[model samples]
Target: MTEAFIPIFYFSGTGNTWWVGNQIAEELQERGCQAQPISIEQVTDDEAHELIEKAAMVGIGYPIYGSDAPLIMQAFIENLPAVTGQKPMFIYVTQAAWSGDGAYFMRKLIEAKGYQIRWAVHFNMPNNINADLGWIITMILKLFQAKLPHAAERAAKLAQHIVDNQPWIMGKSSFLSFGWTQRFFFRKGFDSSHKNIWSVDAEKCTSCGRCVRLCPVDNITLVDGLPQFGDQCNICLRCYNYCPELAILAYKRPYNPQMFGTQPYQGPVSEFKPEMLIEKK
Candidate 1:
């Protein structure tokens, strides 16, 4: 019999979701399933449709931001082609703390498109925000590393459930559903802005165009060798965390670079390269 083919589409801001997706894929493969982890940023709409059409099951992974999936992942889910047979699907999310109904929110969205959500899991990962916290952040990252084995074991269990056709659902409480409102307000505050709140320190910027290349939504562009930001920012923090020189400046409001300083994170894995997320044309 042919092995089941599963494609996991995931979005990672600073590598937490990417690492989890890879772990799940590896576990699934070890269980005699053909699993591939595809970056949401890299997959074209037609390519996504083709993969979903042929896959035995679909997986979605992302990091929780403000108790919700990132804007990029939400858009990807919204644009997905509706399936007729209610294809089985699973979801996983990585977060630093409680995600409330993050997984459930995504389940409802996918269900609206005629997908049956078979399983949903959440993993707590190292906090990517508040990088400027210095030593406190270091301790948190150390804790994440210490718990790595347990996380991997959980991933294996998730894979095993898939292999056995077991149903596991999480974050389904009615009380937790308040996270949907939180997500709505969060998106309205950050995503509805017509003004750009991203900038670069010209002196620190090397004109390397890394930010332009790494932005998942193509909201960054090079203008005369300097990176310029558009109003379509998803606020994923990929460019800010991956910037080599800490040149990228993000403000809570327009024209306020001093509001938050840049402190680039090196990602969860030592060998992670920002360019790896870029789609090869």
Candidate 2:
């Protein structure tokens, strides 16, 4: 029988992971393997599970949040239908800095669903820690422009390994391992206590409602032309990074034009339209 297809199931907050998934899919197809990249937000759990069952190989990619896996990704992995046997899977993470134990957590989650992890790697993209701090991230991205191409090159190399049917293992990515630094910095800085920390300044807000539409969790609602925040935020930072008016504030901090420096992921190679991720209801 011909080899089964490789389906890459990915979750991207802005677009970094999406880019990685698309690149991998392209390389696999070029090497004569059937491949498809699927977005986790656009599919139901049953649909994702069926894709896994029918695939000869699997790939899961997502951005690292709080030095841990995104809650949405964790939920999707947990809800997967039982597999008859272990399937070869590849796990990749996108991070600005260290990914902490995120890869380890993902490996465990996938194994729990009876999948054998063939690779656990990471892609270091531009940092998007606090979208409210866009200016800082902007400066950082400038310094990283010289090094960003390295990430894309590395992704191409990994794709070749898959095309060759090579068994590879890149576990607990560098600077991403669980340690005291991750606990003190990301765990504390990104804790759930900050769920209500976001505030919108009515004076700066133009009632554009961009935050309402960009939020992945539907946590923002427009009330009387002003945006309101809810508890469903995954802290993806889309609303804060993409806001044209700079109206959204995180941690109750005042919006400072000088200090704002966020470079959210924007280089998606695929033809995927992000607006389709929005729920129609």
Candidate 3:
């Protein structure tokens, strides 16, 4: 019999989801299962289908945005081919705080595609959005550090459950689902108008084009050596958070890098780089 292997398709803006997904993958590997964490942005449609078709189980991970999965992840799920024979799948989400029904939202989407969900979990990490806050950021970082081991242990247990075929479904509730529905509609409306919300500070911008390279959706481009925003932005905050010069500004509150001199969160992994998410040709 062939050994079970799982592929975790994940999207991370500032690295929290990527870190968590890798931890889970590592734990799965330690338990004698083959697993790998693949960035959703770097995956091609044909590659995704092949991975899903050959895997014993599938996993999806992403950061929770506005109590739901990011737009890119939602599109990935929507584009997935429905599985035959009810393939086993699991979901995990990373968030700074309460995610409401974020995992449940993904569960419903995947279940609709004929995958039997075996696990759904969330991990609270440092707040990437509010990285500019002074003492608050420090406090959150401390909390994240304290919770790191617990989160990793939980991930290990999740792997063990998968290896043992034990089901552990989380973040599902009628009450939370109701709230999620309202938030989802509001988020969709806000996202539609968010294209023009980002502006580049030409003075601070170094014309390095890092934002253009880091953008998952190709929503940014260089015009006259300056980055320009487009209508397809999923608002992953990658360009904003990963900008070396802190030049990218969002119209939303808490995104004022100029006024706040916001410190960008470089993700949990110290060696992480923006170029790592870029697909290599």
Candidate 4:
């Protein structure tokens, strides 16, 4: 008799973590485990609790922002109620530029809530989403300025890691340290200090409200016919990352034109993970 093992959960803004989560789930299932994929977008507290309760081996996946996981993913994990059952957990972090000790933090928080941290891994994917247009330009310039073919190299290196679980020897990519941002984010990203993290560019914005509708948490609104974001922004930056016109700035950087998907993903290996897709009996 075989046991049905379920591993589910991830937070993706601009679809990076979502992509990565699906890959990890598939890999687990390929090893003969029953893996499930769950998105943190539009996540409700009650639903999260139920999923966490049912997962035999839970996986928490998110992108690396600065030195930590996305604010939205952090909030989701913090809100989960303590489960009576014990399960082995894996913390996965998907990133393009920099990744901090995301697994380290997750293990700490989950342990506080009474759970076991079985393993952790930091994996890099392609930079599908850029920080801002200004940042896009900056990265392009840097890409050309530096003679190194960093993208191609990173992709090759990450793919090998995925297939063999080998350690990557690439240099560090994180721009800032998580220790600097941890204290404040643990409270919430919507606090006064984090308000400016997501802002609209009036000149670039056409009042489409795509950001408003696309936001899983309903954090944006229209005030005076212009999009006005409330205090609760999770800073997923999906508004800007997925915007048709690229109107949102993570801080003040312009949206990059290259954000059109040339970069190799730092998240999931592929869309469906081929192996994880569940077919009807």
Candidate 1 steric clashes: 0
lDDT (0 to 1) per candidate: 0.79, 0.70, 0.78, 0.58
TM-score of each candidate?
A: 0.86, 0.83, 0.87, 0.68
Cα lDDT of model 2 by residue, 1-281, tens digit: 12558888888877778777777777777777787888887788777778877888888888877567676787877887667578778888887765556555656666877888867777787665444445665566456432457677877787877766676665455554543356457656656465776888888899988888777767899998888888777777778766777777776765555443343334443354456444432
Deviation from native of the Cα of residue 237 in model 4, angstroms: 1.9
lDDT preference between candidates 2 and 4, better one: 2
- List the lowest-lDDT window of 10 residues for candidate 3: 252-261
What is the model-wide C-alpha lDDT for candidate 2? Answer: 0.70
> Weakest 10 consecutive residues, lDDT, candidate 1?
252-261
**Which candidate, 1 or 2, would have the higher TM-score against the true structure?**
1
| Model 1 stretches with alpha carbons more than 4 Å out | 131-146, 192-196, 252-263
Predicted model with the maximum TM-score: 3
Query: lDDT at 6 for candidate 4?
Result: 56
Indicate whether candidate 1 or candidate 2 has the larger lDDT.
Answer: 1
Off by over 4 Å in 4: 132-137, 140-193, 197-204, 249-253, 256-281
Model 1 TM-score, 2 decimals: 0.86
Evaluated at residue 52, the lDDT of candidate 1 is 93
Give the number of the best model, judged by lDDT: 1
lDDT of 1 by residue, 112-145 (tens): 8999998988888766664333456545544543
